[model samples]
Every structure is written in C-alpha cells, then in structure tokens.
Target: MIKREGYLIKAGLLFFFIFLEILSGRTIFLISSFSFFTTCVLSRQPIRQGRAMKISHQTVVNRIIVVAGLLFSLSEAYAAALLPDKQQKVNQEAINPEYYQGLSPEEAYQWFRDAFSESRKSTELFVLPETEEEISKRATIFNENLQRIIKENAESVSKGESLRLGITAHADLTQEEFQNRYLTLQLPAKRPEVLPELKGLELQQRLSALPDSFDWRDKGVITSPRNQWFCGSCWAFSGTEAVESFHAIHNNMTVTALSVQQVLDCTPKQDGCKGAWPGVVMDYSKTDGICPESCYRHYYSMELSCKKQLIDKCPTHIKVGGYASVPQGDDKALQVTLLKQPVSVSMEASSFWFQFYLTGVFKASHCHTPAKIDHAMLLVGYGRDSHGEAFWLIKNNWGSWWGQKGYVKVQKDKVNTCGISSFAIYPTSI
Candidate 1:
C-alpha cells in the first residue's frame, strides 16, 4: 500500500512540472522526460513492511516538485528584471531632426533676402488702406518715424530709400491704426559697438586648445533661431534647450523636438509663458517629471492647468545636476571642458548678436551700446577657422531660416561679458 501511494504521488509531481513549463511559455519536452525518469526511479524503490518508512517516497516527491517550481520561477523573475521596458511608439515626423536642417550656405542667403522682401510686401498691403481717414493717419505717422530714422543715420539709408520698421499687426486694430501706432512708438536705434583688438597671443593660445575634429550633426548640436511668439517664456525655452542637450550627451538620447509648452504649463516655479530660471525648471522635473510628447500635448495660458501625472518618473540611470557655468579667466580650461561636456549659456540679446552670422576673424561687439539681449542658448563645441582663429560654435533657437541656417560662430572670448560667459553641463558617466 505504501509503495502504491508513492507511485501515485510521483505521478502527480510529474504533472505539476508539465503545468509550470506550459504556463511559463517554455518547452517541457526535456524537463518532462527527466521528471518521468526520476519519478519511475522513486516509485520502484522497495517498500519496507510493518512500520512504514518515516519519510514516505510520496512526501519526498512532493517536496522536490515544489523546490523545482520555485527555482524556475526565481530564474524567470531575475531575467525579467534585467530586461529594459519597451518604449511607446512615437511618430517619426514629430521628432525628426531633418525637419530643422536648412539650405546650404549660398541657398540660405538667398532665402533670407527673399523672406525679408516678402515680409516687406505684406507690411505694405497693411500700411495703405482704401479708407481715407485710416490711410491719412497711417501715412502721417509712418512718414514721421521714417524721417526721424533717416535723419539720425542718413549715411545708412540712401536718398529715396524706404525705411523698414519691425512691427506686429493685431486683430483689434485696423491696418492703418496698427501702422500708425507702431510708427508713433519710440524705436531705439541699435548702437553698434566697435570691438577692440584682441591680443594675438591670447587668441592663439585658445585656438591651440580646441579639438581638430568634431562633427556637429553626430554630436546632436545645431543652431536654431531666437523665437518669440506672443509669450515672455524665453526662460522656459532656454531651460528646455539645456535639458535637450544634456539628455543627448549623457543619456545618448536625441529628441530634436522639445515642447516649450511643457516648460510653460508644467513647471510650477515658472509662470506659464511668463518666465523662470533654469535652476527652478530642473527642480520641477524632479517631482512632476517630464513626459514624452505622445503623453502630453503642448499647452499654454492660465485657463488650462497642467496635469502632473502624465510625465514619467525619473529614470534610475539618469543623473541630475545644476546648470554648469564656466569660470571667469579660465577660458582655455573652459574650452577643454566644453569639448567633453556641452553647457547652457545666457547672453543679453543673442538675437542681434547672431544676426551677422560672423565667421573666421570678425569684430566682437563691445557692451557700451543699448543692449537688446533677452535670450539664452547652448555652446556645443569650438574649432579654428581657416586662418587658425578660434571660434565658439553656438546653436540658437531661432528657426533654421535665420543666421547661417540656425548657427553662429562667435569670437571666443570677445563677448564674455555680463556672466554671458556662464555655461551649464551634465557630468559624464563611464
């Protein structure tokens, strides 16, 4: 009877093994055959007469089966822990880098001229209207502003040349009203600063320190325009630019696209479309976190409150740090550091600074002028020009349409004024 009971228990143990293999999506052929052989061996063991064996073969078989199941389950659990989670599918169009690339240098110059002409034509249509009262009002104001600017700088504008003013048209105002209002407003002339001669010895030393080879595209560093569209969120855009570069360098991740709305709506310390510092923005990411674009659409305005739950929790692999800034008088050391780590920088009026698309040996702007700076950007890398003059290769946020297709090379140490010299960096992990 004891021997018969042992045989029944062994058979049950073999069936349990088969059940586990099927559930785990593993082949049971080898394990099942081995179980059958082991069961047969145990079942054929001689049964002692009279007093039953203290440890019945049935009890031994049941213990072995449980142990085997536990071992397999543990192994599977370990493997699952090692695997990376799958990323959600995102549209390639949404994050495509090529969308940002601009025309070749020659083609870009032509595009800029064409774009400027087109803008002037559009402004002309709005400046002159059929209404007599409106047309007369606009003409008076327009003539006054144009006369003032030309009178102030007659050399810059030729006789009979039309003066182009930068102005935005609003829906509430008629074309004539908008033009009149714009012209009446005081428009300050940009005082061009004449850069002093930089010491050749210092410049040469800086040039020697830069790496000879660097591929900007492979490094995921490119210039963009300084964009301002109905919002004073330059701070949000600046912070996002730094975050994007840091992710690319340290995490080996590149998303040419980042939402300014994410910074505007989500970060509590920052008022939506208002302004905030990069430091405050980083702190928000620690708590609310950042989500992929699919999870959240870009939003602005006080009417819609940001939902924090949409963002992903911080990844264990990524390391966070404060914005990196270069130390004063350590430009050479800073240049070496930048080659290894990209940093975020803020300059007053980077918009106009990048306007010239100045390259090779060019004059630097002195700070004596009325500053139009209210922007920040990234310092990706640096290299020497054909003449062996050093230049800081910078990326701007203005669309690819502007400035050498969204890039500018500044004289290395010329405009290191107003702590514009500072840059933020993420430490590398080996």
Candidate 2:
C-alpha cells in the first residue's frame, strides 16, 4: 500500500511538471513548480518498507510558509529586473474595444470620467471636471471625439486596415485646444552651419546585417517614459532621454533618468518652455552636461528660475561629445542609426486621429507630412507587429496614461508617417 501511494504521488508530480512545462518561460512557472516539488519532497520523506512516512502538521505548515516566501522573493526579483523604476500596471481596458463598446455619448463620458478617476486614485496625475459647467463642456467635447473614434474604427474595418482608434485622456479637449497646449516642436530659425556628416558607406554595410527587430529597452538602457505635461519641453525630454541612452550604451552604465529641468533652465539661445528643437538641446548638453534627478527635479512646464548655483555644485552625470542629425526624410538611414542607439525624431501630432490614437500601427497618411512636424519623441526601436505591419516604436514624453504606456508604434512607410523620418537626430560619443 505504501509503495502504491508513492507511485500515485510520483505520477501526480509528473502531471504537475508537465503543466508547468507548458508555462515554462515565465517566472511564476519556475517559482510554482519549485515550490510544489519542494512540498512533495517534504511531505513524502523516504518510507521504510514497513513504517509509514510521516510529516507533522506543523512541519507541513512551516514548509508551505517557507515556499510562499521564496515564491514572493523570486517574483519581486524578476519584476525588478524587468522594470527598474517600478511602473504601475497599465489598465489596458481603457483603450480596449469592450470598454467603450455600445456606450452612448453620456455613458461614454461617464466612462471617461471614471477611468480618469481610477487613474488618479493610483497616481494622482489626472484631474477631473469638478464644476458642473466644466463637466458639461468636457462631456460635450468627449462626445464629439467619441464619434470620431467610432467613425475611424469603422473606416479601418471597412478598409481592412490594421490601424485602430480609441478615446484617450485628451478626448475631452478639441484638437485645436490640444495643439495649442501640447503640440510644441519649433525649428531654430537657422540650421546648424555644418551638419553632421552621414557615413553612408559605413551605414550601408551595417544596414544589411540589421536585425529583424531591435529595442534599446531590451538592453536595460532605456528609462521609463516621462510626462511633459503641457510643457513645450518635449525638446528637452527627448534630448535628455537620448543623452541618457547614449551615455549608458557608451559607458556600459545602468540607465538613469537625468534632469530635463536642467536643460530647460540652463540651455542658452532659446526659451526652454516656449519650444526648441531636440538637436539643439542635445548640443547644449554636449557642453554644459546634465545632472541626475537627485540634483534637479522636473516641474512639468511650471516656470522656475534656472538653478545654476545648485546645478554647478552637483556632479555631472554624463557629458555627451556631440550630436548628429540624420538626413531629412531618410528613414532607411534612420533605421541603421537606431541600431546603434535610440534616435530623436519629430512628428505632426495635432490632427484629431493622431491626438486620440490608442493602439495599433498608426498609419493615417493624411495627417503625416514632412513639412509639418510639430512634436518631438524618441525612436527607441522598430519591429513588425503580429499582423506583419512594420512599425517604429517611439517613446513619447506624455505620461504613462497616453498610448501604450507612453509609447506609440508608427507604421513604417515611404511617405514617412507623421514625418517621423524628417528631422531625425541622435546623440554621439559620450
């Protein structure tokens, strides 16, 4: 009977092992399988042919407690490795079809308010329409945006397109309002007299060997997405983030969030909050160099005095050698450069479709134009989506609440979707 019991336990464990094998690569799978295997070992000690193997109730409870503790530790360690900054879990349903499906204008507005409220509960980063008048106006605008989203999704389905549209936090505001407040990328009046020379032959050699997909984030060198928040300082954020990546890649240092406030405060020849080009900001960092967040903090477009006295005293984290500008409208060139490091690029982000974009390869050709780039973002990676649509994964300055946890995948196209290929730039030697 004892021998038969051992066979039964072994058989059960074999089935459990098979179950865990199906979930093989995940952290939970390893943790759970190990815990169960350990429990089995503790519960079923070597039994002499005549004597029954026994595990005390207290011992079993103690073993379970130990296993639970081990599981928690392993899970936390895995999570930390993947997300250093500890980002909050994204509520993907907010952008999902089922979340807004079949809701009327009023109901949709309520859903929007509830979504923001829930987000605020966790992050306190969003504000709701408090006054009755404000609430009514926002509801009306949200209704209009919702209609556009519905129409766009319908058009996408009819055209058999992979592109999708959904309501975002900006849905409560008109496109004009969003543009005036958020879309801020302005070119310098005069270009840099001597543009960085593109090494065409060298780049061509590397292009042939380019991987099917590449992401700097995978290398643990890209920091979490930050919100510019009505700050026309995307130029500063993009410049800062690009510098951070370049420095980490070159020096083999861990990715760190440097101070964008310093860029806004210290960069000369431009109003940091009033909008400036990202390349120029990076050029500024090449000389002055930026400090880490511990030394300076971002105020989200709030006007503040440039704290030069404090910044001067703090340790300079990484000083970039210089920056290079990719040839305008040359996306293939941009792709090769991206393999080396993350690149800074600008796009036209004021259109209704672009403003309310939720997920999927953003392929609205009408809104994209080379001459109309109005926002700055970091081109972190590129790859094909599940449907085989090629896309450029860009990190936006907007908070995690916007677009795929503060990133958007633009459809790779010849026309350059949203002029992403136009005015591309990346930092050089650290």
User: Candidate 1: where is the Cα deviation over 4 Å?
Assistant: 1-209, 212-216, 221-228, 299-304, 312-319, 350-363, 369-373, 386-389, 413-419, 423-430
Writing each residue's lDDT as its tens digit, candidate 1 over 338-425 gives: 6655655555443211322222322244232443334455667666666565566666654343344455555564545423454333
The lDDT of each candidate is: 0.44, 0.73
lDDT of 2 at 45: 36
Per-candidate TM-score against the hidden true structure:
0.47, 0.73
Residue 138 error, candidate 1, Å? 9.2
Candidate that would win on TM-score: 2
Candidate 1 lands at a TM-score of 0.47
State the TM-score for model 2.
Answer: 0.73
Best by lDDT: 2
